[model samples]
Target chain A: MRRLTDVGALREAYDLVIVGAGPAGMAAAVEAAGQDRAVLVLDENPGPGGQIYRAIGTAPLRDPRVLGAAYWEGAALADAFAAAEVDYLPGATVWHLDDALEIGVSAGARSAVLPARRVILATGALERPMPLRGWTLPGVMSVGAGQALLKAQGIAPTGRVVLAGCGPLLWLYAAQCIAAGAAPSLILETTPRANWRGALRHLPAFLATPYARKGLALMARVRRHLRVVPHVAALAIDAEDGALRVTWAEGTAFTADHVLLHQGVVPTLNLARAAGCAIAWDEGNACFAPVTDAWGTASLPGIAVAGDGAGIAGAEAAALRGRLTALEALRALGVLDEAGRDARAAPHRAALARWSRGRAFLDALYRPAPHFCAAPPDAMACRCEEVTGAALRDAARMGATGPNQLKAFLRCGMGPCQGRMCGPTITETIAQERGIHPREVGYMRLRTPAKPITLGEFAALRKTEADRRAVERR
Target chain B: MFRRLPEPPARRIGFSLDGVAVQGAEGDTVAAALLALGRTACRETAVSGAPRGPYCMMGVCFDCLVVIDGLGNRQGCLVPLREGMVVETQHGRRDAAR
Candidate 1:
C-alpha cells in the first residue's frame, strides 16, 4: 500500500483518470493501461476495496466462501493495477470535476489537480440510513460502519450488538460479527424469510458461484448463535442504564449494548451529478442512479460511470463493468479495433448477465418495507428541518403532492445530509397523503457541489473560475 | 428471555414533550428518553393517523421526528436533551391548519 502524500503536485497527464480504486475503478485502471494508455486511479481510502472488499485486517476468516471471494478478487485487482503500471493515488478524495476533464482532489491536508482525456467514476455506494428515534445514541451504527470498524480497526462496536435491518448485508455482517466473537444478541431482519422464495428463483445463478453457497452456509451457522427475527422491524430504541432498550413491531423487546442498522445501499452519485451526468430514479433501490450505457459510458462524450456510481451491483458485477468500460473507452479513443472490443467485452457481458440475476434477486428480497414511510404525525419525517409526518400530510392535503412543494413549505430536503436519507420517505409520505404513487412525485433537483465543501475550497474555486472567465472575455 | 432492567439513578432533567412533563437523562436525546418512557405514539399520521415511533436510531430514518423548542419538526434522535427542552408532538405535515 503506497500512500502518496502530494499527488496533485506530481502531475503528468494520464489517458484516463479513474476516481475511486475499488473493484470497478481498479479493473478499469488495469484494462485501460493495458492498452498502453496512461491510467491513474484516485481513491479516498488508504487501500482499495471501497467498502465491500474492505481490508480484512486479520487473516482471511476460516470460511472463505462468504466475503473471502470478494477479498481475493480485490487482492487480484490490486495486483493487476501494480502489473499494469497504473499510477495510483491513494487517500485522495476527488472533490471537483470540470467539463474540461479537470479534476480537483484532496489528500488529507494537501490538494492537487489532475487533468485527463477521459474520466471514469466508480465511487460506489453508501449504506442508506433509516433514521428512527434513539438512533443517535453512541451504541447505534450502520451495519457497513460496524463491519468497517471490525475490518479496519479490529474492534467490535460492542460485544452484544443487535443486528437489525433488511438485505443480504445484514446476514453477511451478522456472520462476520459472530465469527469475530462479538456475536450479536439478536438479528432483527425487516425482510421476511418468504422473500427468499423469490431469491430461490435465481438459484441457477447462485449455484454457479461456490463462494455464494459458502456464504449461505456461514449465515446458517451464525443463525444458531443469534436469534433470527424475520419480518420484524425495530420500532424504537431507548438507552437505559448504558444499554439499548429496543422494541420491534411484533411486540418483542430486547436489550443490547449496541445496534447495527442496515437498509441496503444507495448509489454514490455525487460525483456523477457534479459532472453533469443525467440521473434516473431507480425505484427498486429507492434512489437515483446515473444513466449509463451498457459499456458504462455516461451521457457525456468523454466521461463514463461504472460500478455502484452507475448502479448498485456487488463486486463481481462492478469488476465486469470496469473491464467492459475500459474496452468501450478504448474503442472511443480509437485505440481498439471492432474485433478487439468485441473479444474483450463478450465474456464480460455473459458474466454481467449472471451477476445481475443475483443482484436483482437480492434487490427484490431486500426492498424496503411498505410501512417504512408511514410516519405518524408526531414522528419526524425530515431530520434536517424536523418536519413531522403531520406537517408533510397537511401539505399534501393542501395540494402539495411533490417533494419540491413540500420542501418549499417545510424545508425537508434542505439540510446538511442533503436528503439522501429522508428524500424517499418524504416523497412517499407526500404520495400517500395525496393518494398518488411515489413515481408521480418529482425527484429532488441536484446542484453542483453535491457534498458539503469547505468555505476555503469554494472561495478558491470561485476565484479561479472568475479569473478564467475574465481571461476568456479578454 | 431478557428482563427489562430498572432505570438507572442518573441525574434526570425534566422537560415538556407536547405539554407533557417528561423526565430524561441530561445527555439523552429527546427521542431516546421519550422511547424509554414508553411514549411510542410520538405523533399521528397526516393522512391515516397511524401511530409512529423511532425507527432508525441514527439520523437517517427520519422516523423519530418531534417539534423541539417551537420548531415544528426536528429529528429527535439527533437533538440532545437539555434541562428544560420544550418538545411538541408533531401531528401532521407542518402546513396543516390546526
Candidate 2:
C-alpha cells in the first residue's frame, strides 16, 4: 500500500477524508474510492486494520486456531483496500478539525490541513473504565492492551495469567488465549447475575438473529472449556512478595504474574466531539454517542460517522454501516441519484439491523459494573495526572459541574494521552454525583493541536507561496 | 508467556534499546521488539516515577512512550523498528529533563 508521508503530497482538499481505517473506515474507503471519488483514508496505525483486525495486512495468520476466523476475515478487506484507488495515509495523526471540515494532520514531523468536501469518522471504540484498588500495579492492565500485543506482534502474556472483568471480549480473548496455547488459569466475570432477566428479554430476538446466535455458540464453547467465575463484585490487585494477588468480593484470591482486565468498550469520540457533531447519551450503551441517521449521516451536512464510534455495533455491523455511509455520502456528493443510493444502501441497512439484534442482551448482560464505572475513592481515576476518585468527586461536589470547568480545578484530563483513559469514568462519576445524565455532564471541550505536537514540528510545517495565494484569494 | 507460532515473522532486523544491541523482525514495532526481549518497562511516570510499559499496543495508551532516534515521547508500539535505530527509555514527559 502506498502511504502518503508528505502532508502536501496530494492537495489542500479532497472529495472525502475518512478519519479511520478500521472495518468501518476500510469499507467506506473501498466503496467510495471504487465509485471514483477522490478519497483519502488516514489512520495513526501502520496498517488498515484497527484494533480488532490489527496486523491482518502484514500477513494472514494461517492458524485460525489462534486468533479465530473473525480475526483472519479482516484480510479480505485489507486486500480490497490495497487494490482500491483511494489514497491511504498510514502513520498520519490528525490532531484537529475545524468547523469548516478542515483536518490538521501530523505525518511524522510535518503538519498540514486537508479540507474535505465530506468527512467520515470511523474512529472506533475504547475499553470501558475499569479502575479499581491496586489496579495500577505493574502486572495489571486492560485485556484490550494484552490483546493488542497478541494481535500486533503475537506476544502472549506469560506465566500465571488471569483474565478478569465482564464483556464479550473477555470470553473471546480467554478462548483465543487458550487456542493460542497460553491459556489463562482463571477467568473472573464481573457481570451481575441479575442481568440475566434483562438479557432474556432480548433472547427471542437474539436466537433468531444470525450474528447473535454465533456469539451465543461461541460463549457456550468458551464456558465449557475455560474455568469462569461469575458475579464478582469487589476486586483488588496487590503485589504480595513478588507475584500480583487478585482478590474478589467472595474472599477469593488468585495470584498471577499478569492480570488482564476487560469490562466493555465505548466509542472513541475525539474527532466527532471536536467536529461539533451533535451527541446524545445512549443509556443502553452507557456513553454519549454521536447522533446519526440510518445511513450514518450525522447532523452536519458534510460529516458522517459509522460503526462503533457512532455507537457500539461490533465488527460485522460496522462494515455494513460503513457501506451504507458511503452510499449516503456518494448520493450527497451527487455520485448517485436518490434511487441509486437507496437501492445500494438497502441491503447494508438490513444487514445492520441483523447485526444489531443481539446488542440489547449483550449490553444488558455486560454493562460495566457500577463500581467499575464510578471507580472507588481510592482508585486512580486519571492515570495521567494521577488524580484519584475522591479528588474528582470533591471537584464535582464543589460545583465543578462540567468536565471543562473540572479540568481547571484539577488536571484530570490534561495529559499526554488526552482524556482517552479517564474521560469515561470522570463523566460517569460527575453524572452520578449531580443526579444527571452523562450528556448533561458533557465531555471535555476540545481544542486545536488535539494530539500533542512539538513546537519544532509546528515551525517546520510545509508552506508554499501557492498555498498562501490560494488562502489570500479566499 | 507470548511466543510466535510456527510461522516466523517475514523479516528480521537489528536495533538498539538503551544502547544495547537487540534484533527484531522487520514488521516488529519497537514496543513488540522490546517485549520480545523481555524489556517491559519502557519508561517511568513523570510524577510518581513508577515503571510503565506498553499497556495498549494499538497507540491508545501512552504508557509505551520512548525516545526513538532523536524524537522523544514517540509511541513505542506505533513506531516500527529499523536497522541501527537508537531507542532510549523515556524518562517522563518530554518537557521534563531526561
Candidate 3:
C-alpha cells in the first residue's frame, strides 16, 4: 500500500471523490474507475475495510460457509479494490465538505484540502446508545466497539462477558467474541424468538444467498456455548466490589466481568448535512438520513450518498448502492451508454429489493422496545443541560408539544455533544406524551460547525483559508 | 485456594448529589458513584411514565444523565466529578424548581 505524506500536495482533482473506504466507498471507487473516471477513496482508518471487514489479517476460517457470506464477498471486494487504479487515502478524516465539492481532510495534526468533480458519502453508521445503570463502569462497552477493539488490538475487556442487545449483528458479534476465546457469559437478546417467525416468512430470499444461510448456522453454533435469552431487555447494570452486576427487565440478574450492549445503528450524516445536502427524517429508524435519488445522487447534482450515510442498509445493500451510484455518475459523464448503465443496474436493483425486505423484517422484529424512551423520574435525558426525565415530563404535562418546545423550556438539546445522544429519545418521549408521531415532533435545529471545534482552531482555519482563496482569486 | 487481594485504595473526590454531599473515587464516573449508592431512578421519561438509569457506559448510550454544577443533563459516565461540584437529580430533562 502506498502512503502519501501530504494529501494536500496533490493538486490534480478527480472525477469522483468517495469519502469512507469501507464496502460502499471501495465499491464506488472500483466501479467508477472502471468507467475511466479518476477515483479517490478517503478513509479515517488505517485500512480500506470498515468496521465490518475488520480482522483482515486473521486468515479466513476453514469453514467457508461458517465464515458467512459477507466474509467471502468482502474478500472478493478487497481484491476488486486492489486491482482498480484508485487513489486510496487511508487515515484521512474528511472533516468538512462544501457544496462545491471541496473537501477538508485532517490526518493527525496535518490538514489538507482536495477538490473533486463529484462526491460520494459512504460514512456508514454508529451504534445506538442503550443506557442502563452502572453502564459507566470500565468494562462496559458497545458490542461494535468491543469487536473493533478485538479486531484492531486483539484485546478483550474481560474473560467473561455478557452480550446484550437486539438485531442480527448481536449473534454475529457473540460468535466472534467466542472465537476470540473470551466466552460470553450469556446473550441477552431483546429480539423475541416470535419475531423470527416473521423473518422466516422471508426465508426464500435468505435461502437464495448461501451467505445468509451460513450466518444463521454460525449463530446456531455460537448458541451452544452462549445461553441465548430472547425477548429480554437489560434494565440496569451496577459495579460492585470487583465484578459487574446486570439486571434484566424479566426480573433476572447476572454477574460478569464485562457487559457488551448493542442497540441498532443510526447513519452518520453530519458531513452530508454540513455539505448543505438536503436531508429527510426516516420514521422507520427515528433518525435523519441524507436524501438521495434512485441512483444515490443527493439533492446536489454532483454529490451522491450511498451506504449507511444514505440509509441503514447492511453491507450487501451498501455495495449494490455504491455500484449503482457509480453507474449513474458514469452515465452522467457520458462514459457509459444508457444500455450499459441499465444492464449493470438491473441485477443490483433486484438484489437491493431482496435485501431491503430482509432488512425491513429485521427492523420490525428488533424495533426499539416500546419503553426505550421512558426515562426514570430522576434519570437524565439531556446530558448536556442536566435535564432529567421528570423535568421533561412536567413540561410535557404543561403542553410541551415537541422537542423544540421542550428545548426552549429545559435546554435539553443545547449542549456540547449536541443532541446526537438524547435527541431521538427526547423526540419520542415528547410525541408519546402529546399523542403525536415522532416525525411530527421534528428534529433539533443544527447550526454549522456541527461538531465541537475549539475557538482557536476555527478562527485560524477561517483566516488561513480565506487568505488563500483571496490569493487564488487575484 | 489463593484468595484474591483486596482492591487498592481508590482515589476519591467530593461532590453533591441532589443537594446531598457525597464522595466518590477518582476513576468512578458520576453515574457509577450514584448507582453504587443505590440511586436507581436517575431520571424520568417525559411520556410513558417509565424510569431510566444508566444503560451503556461508553459515551454512546445517553442513559446515565445527571445535573452537574450548573449544566443540566450531562452524561454521568463521560464526566469526572470535581471537588465541591453541585450535582442534582434531573427531572424530565430540566432542573426541579428550587
Top candidate (TM-score) = 2
**Across residues A292-359, which tens digit of lDDT does each residue of candidate 3 receive?**
98999999879999888788888888888998998888887788888999998999899898777655
Go through the candidates in order and give the C-alpha RMSD of each one to the true structure: 10.2, 2.8, 9.5
Give me the runs in candidate 1 sitting further than 4 Å from their true place. Answer: A1-3, A10-13, A56-69, A110-114, A193-212, A283-286, A373-391, A461-474, B1-98
* TM per candidate: 0.75, 0.94, 0.74
Best candidate, DockQ: 2
lDDT by residue (A1-474, candidate 2, tens digit) is 456866767666788888889999999988887676788999988888988888885642457778888888888988888888888888888888767988888886778877898888888998876888777776677898878777776777888888889988988888777777777788888998788877888877777776676677777777777688888888888889978899986668988888888889998877777777888889899888889987788877789998899999899889888888888889878899999999887878777777788679788888876777876788888887888889998988899988888789988878887888888888888988788877788778756666888888876766678866977855
lDDT of 1 by residue, B7-50 (tens): 23446789997787888754456766775565654655454444
Where does candidate 2 chain A have its weakest 10-residue lDDT segment?
A57-66
TM-scores, chain B, all models: 0.83, 0.87, 0.80
Task: Return whichever of 2 and 3 wins on TM-score.
Answer: 2
Error of 3 at A220 (Å): 2.7
Instruction: Rank candidates by lDDT, best first.
Output: 2, 1, 3
Best-to-worst ranking by TM-score? 2, 1, 3
lDDT of 1 at A474: 56
Q: Tell me the tens digit of each residue's lDDT in model 1 across A288-376.
A: 78888878888877889988878888888898898888888888778998899989899899988877765666676787765555455
Which residue segments of model 3 deviate by more than 4 Å?
Answer: A34-36, A55-69, A192-212, A281-287, A354-357, A373-388, A391-401, A404-418, A450-474, B1-98
Q: Report the C-alpha displacement of residue A336, candidate 2, in angstroms.
A: 1.4
Report the lDDT of model 2 for residue A15: 89
